[model samples]
Target: MEVVNQFVVSPCVSVCEVDERDICVGCLRTLDEIARWGVMSHEERMHVMTELLPLREAGDVT
Candidate 1:
């Protein structure tokens, strides 16, 4: 068996303020996402960092 280590870092930019929509203005994560980040799996964190955050930044997602 191979042991693989995976680490997904948080996207917090130290702004730490939610907008009117309850999305973080710095990291572009929803309040729920932020709250669940620590408990989320590696894949989930990657999804947020790679897919979701980009869409949010591009205004493709609300």
Candidate 2:
């Protein structure tokens, strides 16, 4: 038997404050994303970590 463990780490840095745009200044996640993190699937989390967060950080996203 083989076991595969999948864990999606949170980007929170303890700076829990949302900007005027409702994005977290610490983790760079939007308020909705942060609120939904606990219930989001692995793929969803990956999208946030890989795509959304990067775009947000780069100022490409709102």
Candidate 3:
């Protein structure tokens, strides 16, 4: 696998809201994930991006 050196393209769609489970409605990131994004390494952000699917499927976000 290749490691990307730039900040992962943010999944945010300008609609920022967290559901009761703490998942963002816009990007499907949890509150902790969102809070940590700015300081996270590029690879870290990418990993977080990849983790969104399960959150979405689990009904955490639309």
Candidate 4:
């Protein structure tokens, strides 16, 4: 049997802190999402990335 390996990039911009909106401005991810990323499904991570892309385009970096 072969195992399917999925991978993702770390969203670290140096500063690590969760904002009032529960999203990490640096990584554009929610604190809970970040904590559970390693075990999250590929589809779930993709969803997070989709949510992040717009914020990045909007210059919402931290």
Model 2, range 1-62, lDDT digits (tens) per residue?
89766689999999999899999999999888999999999999999999998999999997
lDDT of 4 by residue, 1-62 (tens): 99867676766676788777777767777788789989998888877777664665486742
C-alpha-based local distance difference test score of model 3? 0.76
Model 3, position 35, has a per-residue lDDT of: 85
Ranking by lDDT: 1, 2, 3, 4
In the range 1-62, model 1's lDDT, one tens digit per residue, is: 99878788899989999999999999999999999999999999999999999999999997
Off by over 4 Å in 1: 1-3
**Superposed model 3: Cα runs more than 4 Å off:** 1-5, 54-62
Best by lDDT, which number?
1
TM-score of each: 0.90, 0.90, 0.69, 0.65
Backbone clashes for every candidate come to: 0, 0, 0, 0
lDDT of 3 by residue, 1-62 (tens): 99756857778788999888887777788788888889998778877777655658686644
**Residue 20 CA displacement from its true place in model 3, Å:** 1.0
Cα deviation of 1 in candidate 1 (Å)?
5.7
